[model samples]
Target: MITKEKILERVGGEEYLIRHLVPTFSSKVRKKNYKSIFSEKDDKPSMSIYKERGVWKFKSFNTGHQGDVFRMWADYYGLDCRTQFKELLELIDQEMCLGLNAERKSIVTPKSIFPNSPTVKDPAASFPSQTLRIEYMSDYESFISRLYLKYWLQYGIDQSVLEKFDVKQVSFLSYTANSGRCLSFKYFEKHQVVSAYHISGRVKVYIPEIAFSFSSDPYFKGQKKSFSYKNQNKDDVFGLVQLPEGNLDYILFTAGEKDCMSAYAHGFSNVISLQSEHQMPSEDLLRVLRSKTSVLLCCYDNDEAGKNASKKLRDSFGIVSVQLPEDVKDIAEYFQRYTPNDFQLLLGYGVQQVQSITVNPIDTHRVRRLSNTKRSKVKSYLSNKFNFRLNVVTQEREMSTKRNPGLWEKINVNELRDNLDRHGFECNLDLINCILKSFFVERFNPIEAYFLTFEGNEFDDGKDYIRRLAHYVHLKDPTPFNTRYWYIHLKKWMIRAIRTVFEPEGINKHALILCSPKENIGKSYFCEFLCPLSLIRYYNSNPVISNEKDAQKSLIRNFIINLDELHQLRSNAHVIKTWLSQRYVNIRLPYQEDEITASRIASFLGSTNDVEFLRSDLGHSRWISFEVESIEYIDDEAKYILEKSWEQAYHLYKLNPGSGELSKEELLELSQRSDQFTTKSTEAELMVQYLTPSTKELGEFMTATDILRYLQEIVGITIRLNTKLVGTSLREAGFDRVMHSDIKRYGYFVQKGLI
Candidate 1:
């Protein structure tokens, strides 16, 4: 009672049998050249089935379809073909019987075993099925389709069997979003047609690629950056890219590599960021959108800074900033807060993808520091206090209380003058004027005049001023140059400038320091150290601080200058190189005032950016850019030999000094000789030796974070730390990369004396 349908279930169908069985098992065994399972060429399917007492079974396969030729191999091998067939069936069930492919034996109770039509006792179980489940070596649409078309008769859903696919049943799955592009499936229900999912109203996230290594550890933590820090493949992400030739489009930038990854999952193209090396200019983005005209939409942060940056980018890209309701911020929020219809209206169909910018302006500390209202107060306070006759100018542009444009020098000088005058003693205007007029060299201190004014008095005004200056210097703004040296120098210079206020050229000689309330909030370190250092120089009436030859002193100045710009910088290495290489680069000085006049003290000492530019210009002559950790607390008691510390430090700087602006080549040579001075481990030639990166310390300091914290401590930034959020503090301190390393190093140094 073997039936045709029953046979077909196992051997595919008539087509499969004719191509494999018929030729190998024709009427005559000798004529058909029949071979046994042991025969060299017995792999023909004609003899695939075992026959004993009208019973048949299958044999295990050799490589691919070996079991299909089980009988032939069995007969050739002269073994019990039935046993081989049974063994093959068992193996097949174990490997492929799971899912819908599990075999359904004949309820067909075969009625005959004739050649024309395989006999079966019954036909119900023999009838092919309408449903089927299949798995491929990989998820590939074409491969899935090919497997179905080629083997349809076996699954009972082939076109010849079922005739069509029930497409609605086709569903895809993946661990991540963008891993579905390679999936393809179709369904066929004997005489019925199936409809696919409707695309009219739904937003489908399209997966552009499927290439991810299955991770074993479910709780694995990812690297903080966009790229894999260790053992990462480029293919880890589904890169859905828009070609450059697409030309001109308004680009909306977002945040995080994952955000971009998710958008790519949706198949929307044109979004790009740090994922690729080629940075598309705003003009280029606009150019592509020219043909397919559409207003650009920025679904970035709803924060004030985010809005400003979005607007700024829109302007640069020649696009309009689509305003969202006050409550909604990003695309995800747009959906969560509104109905589907509203969301669709907001995000028009067929638009470009979203990408978040990484090297953005807001990330700079200076920008963040200046943006706060209370922080800006410092800029204003100092500005008006310096010069009551003029308004202050600050970089915190949103504040209305910022000083007016121009008159920075007059303002800063006036503030210091007013403070001194309040103490009941008049500023020594003439002596200061004389000192500045004759101060021609790169190095000199004018502070001796102040000390001289109070030389015989214990309640000395000069000492009090120096003390106040020191207190603020301890405030430690990250940019220590100004905090330690320049602030003090500027204060003294302003006092001198104001004393000669009636003299020619006295009105605009110094830069202004406009302070808004809380302006120096946590940024007091710079004012503390740099200002004091500057005082030690300017207050001395000694022509030395500027030209101090202490190898350590020069290095400290270079470090301070670098840290300031580094505050406003994203690429410290690149900026440092440019600075050391003597190339000019524009750095938008963080404005102290929101608005400014033509003649304002935008930067009293100098713009951090300008200072950065000069680092390279004077590399060899002024310094070699040696790396060092900023000192947390210099032993003031041990620091100076009162009579000779200045002279000793000065001598160190003059040792291998070059005159004027030293070239890169000269700097390299000097640094080489300095490091190789007979013994590098002992009695340092350069300060780097004495100031080690704690064998336990980071290469540049107590981890850049601790150094930044040290800087913040000295300068003061209003940062609140969780007792447990060590990582967060390190991140904010700017030593985000090796924060743990830094903290560990710091601890190690204290415990091991490695620094």
Candidate 2:
């Protein structure tokens, strides 16, 4: 059972044997020869190693003696290759720790073979512990023939990158729980393969003879692919050897060798990889790296294991952790799905400080209201009493906190002054401003620097928030008409509201409109409650839109801008629509000298006590209108719902921000369902008296002009027929738009009905 092939496979291939047999052999050297070990003393170094037919062979020109690795191994023991081949296999299996012996008898290695070998003390020690003895082959034919390069190519990794990282194609791999000739990737250190990372299942091998002679095609067979690591020498890091010397800005440590190479292929350098996410370099090695680089960033697989490992590295060594999207497993797969620029956008989110502190809000309130606090005590009071925490935390153009972990806005000096003044603490404006600047520069805890958004609550999962939102709609609009789409719109709006808090630039274009026939329906009160209590200061129920600039300022400053009395804005419909569509506002605050482009963070919520608040014209899709029977007072429930929902939304947004986006199809469906809320036009009602939608038995295809002319002449309608109104009326009267296929023109399918 212990054959030469099995021994060779266990010790890595022929290439591995040669590298290990001759310790002085350097694969990097070209046309270089080493002194022959077979001869007693050769005057000249005449033995050279070269590849022949996918195998590594050695030859000595001095004595005209040369053969494969087996011949060389036998010659080292002063035995003939042909006669002593069996003994050579046994010696290899024992010395290399192949564990191939069936009888469990320990055959001693020949003293002559390892006469000066360092591993002679331990006969089974051919490689360094925990490192791999990876086989290397220069035969591009085997690499191409096995079709192993395609796996890396699909992840945007080319042959050059694979070769750069010393990745080799393995046609045959034998390990525990796996033995096959399937195509796999072997990661080697110089000439010896240490680790194996399989990217795909078994690939069909291209048999040249079978294909060229037209005898048969490539064979298709499937095998259980595996990922494994083996060790031969101390060199474990994949890209560490290739790293440039000293003083780098940043170096990325990825989950695997492929992820490292993938980053390099995407135009990022100074990157290295671990054996796996779980394996980290020694403390000494990490310290040396820290001195050489400004920052060490680790981007591991998006799984729980990778996340935990990355966090450990961050906590232990101050290495920054870069988070990957939930869908991607690793950086290689990330590049496969997204562009390099998309990855660059995430780099800013990773450069965070190692430490973060949390301050108690109750203590902060107590500190702010202290009567004895003077200029000298400002720092101590803010730091100790107010419980202000600080850190250099950046998350996609905003500060991210550990407690509330999303984007947050930094509070300006004016806002801080206002807060202190309101809390009954009197301090000079200049001193207050100076202390704030110093605190900011010092990178104090997050709360002192940025405005606090809603923190995630463990008890709430957002289901109640969703339930309340659904119930809120049902209570406002008791009618069964379009209830399904209303709920759909409400869910989407809530998602967008959450998104706006995290991603300020993400505009929530649609506004929820609550209409009622009577004034006592509590529409405005519910709209006011839509904003969370924490953000109630930024909620304006009576937004003055008379001055357009003021309206823009309101949008820029507020979290929720309620456009109350929707009927009062009938003449301002075009302006309101324009405001709804805007993603940014170009305006200057009183504190700023020049106008600055600011993102629109405000979400609109409207209320009206008029039944026909909506106009006859189109462009009402942005107004999510509903007729309310009544909105009963549920103050406590509403506050709890708003607060908890925001927290839940924040959690969900962090997971996937793109989930808030509305597709074109979804918008169109919502738009169609919104038709019931639009006030009916007089012309539409008049046309409905005589016209009905097409029936198979009787109908006529007519253009808007033709329909208007018929209504004016045949029906003797004296009212001035507006062209656009006629088209709108036709659709309103259940006249379906149809194409006159023969004439190649669009017309309405209509039939004459009794008045």
Which candidate has the highest lDDT of all? 2
With candidate 1 superimposed using the best TM-score fit, by how many Å does residue 642's alpha carbon deviate from the native? 35
* Top-scoring candidate (TM-score): 2
**Per-prediction TM-score, please?**
0.17, 0.42
**Global lDDT scores for all candidate models:** 0.30, 0.60
Worst window of 10 by summed lDDT in candidate 1: 223-232
RMSD in Å for candidate 1, one decimal?
32.3
In terms of lDDT, model 1 sits at 0.30
Candidate 1 TM-score to native:
0.17
State the lDDT of candidate 2 residue by residue for 113-154, as single tens digits.
Answer: 334543222233222221112233446554233344555676
Clashes of each: 147, 13
lDDT of 1 at 94: 22
